[model samples]
Target: METDAPGEPGPTAERDATIEIDVLVVPDCPNRQLAEERLRQALDETGLRAARLTTRTVTDGTTAARTGFTGSPTILINGRDPFAEPGAVPSLTCRMYRTQDGLDGAPAAARIREALRAAAAAGGGA
Candidate 1:
């Protein structure tokens, strides 16, 4: 991890200290690509290149429940469901997120990116 400047925690200090993120998706949904793209953009914007971003497909409700898998395109930051709210269930069904516009199966790119940055700043790691 490289530092963007002196005196600041090297990129490694923050990005390496924590901030592992992943996209939990179902194979049936094609929106996973969008999620990945959004994640990549977030990483770039937040300087989390070594964050080890990846993806996992939720194949069963049991795994979903364990992982708090709400549906395809579930973005997990440090193994925690950032998208999971109070009433969300671990279902194999598709997940939806509330955006400024309306409800959608995936979260907005900017929203996800900001969350990623915050998680990184907080040293949130898996």
Candidate 2:
């Protein structure tokens, strides 16, 4: 693992090997759990279990804005918000995820898998 500080060097190599994941959500959204399951399934499908998985609850618009939390189930790899696009609108309401079949609350498991793999290849993001 690498660290910004000159001598910190981050966690041990083994400890740092795990992929960092963030599942950002809001309290009222009904898809939070489904999002978690989907992410886990994606990780399993991609054989990325060594990576770490985490979840965060967005309490207010301020936090959402600060984190650019699109809505419930916004996944972040490392410190970057992979689900967020350059010109996407920021809001507190529930968000819709685009899937092959149609729009849905939960992102497709395969899409999550692809995002995870891309994030890993990108060296865990900024």
Candidate 3:
């Protein structure tokens, strides 16, 4: 197999290029900034700094349902919710993530990184 050169795009790089990241939040969501910051850190750590990132506002239940938004500060990796529990339903509310310590408003950077890597590996951008 061909190997990537230094400073060149590797398999992960190619996969990251095709990944799309979306942060869905409601107006005045308290955790939006934290979620965004963690996401940015994860992208940078994963060498996906150039990945497409979009922040969308979910103002109402209609918009939430239309966009498959489970809650405010929901992070979507290639349109999939890697952190969502089974049977999660769209709603206009703040989302919580279960961390090692306890529940938190925003997912940890490591979690985001894992999600990004998984998405890339799974050919999620398609």
Best by TM-score: 3
Candidate 2 achieves a global lDDT of 0.74
**Which is the leading candidate under lDDT?**
3
**How many clashing residue pairs appear in each of the predictions shown?**
1, 1, 0
Off by over 4 Å in 1: 5-14
- What TM-score does prediction 2 earn? 0.78
Candidate ranking under TM-score, highest first, comes to 3, 1, 2
Tens-place lDDT per residue, model 1, 22-52, is 7888876778877788788877776676677
Model 2 / residue 5 / CA error / Å: 32
Colliding pairs, model 1: 19-124
Per-residue CA lDDT of model 3 for 1-126, tens digit only, reads: 224688998876677678998899999999999999999999888777768899988898888887789888998888888888889899998899999989999988898989987786686552
Give lDDT per model, in order: 0.76, 0.74, 0.84
Query: Which scores greater on lDDT, model 2 or model 3?
Result: 3
Ranking by lDDT: 3, 1, 2
After aligning candidate 1 to the native by TM-score, how far in Å is the CA of 72 from where it should be? 1.3
What's the TM-score of each model vs. the native? 0.82, 0.78, 0.86
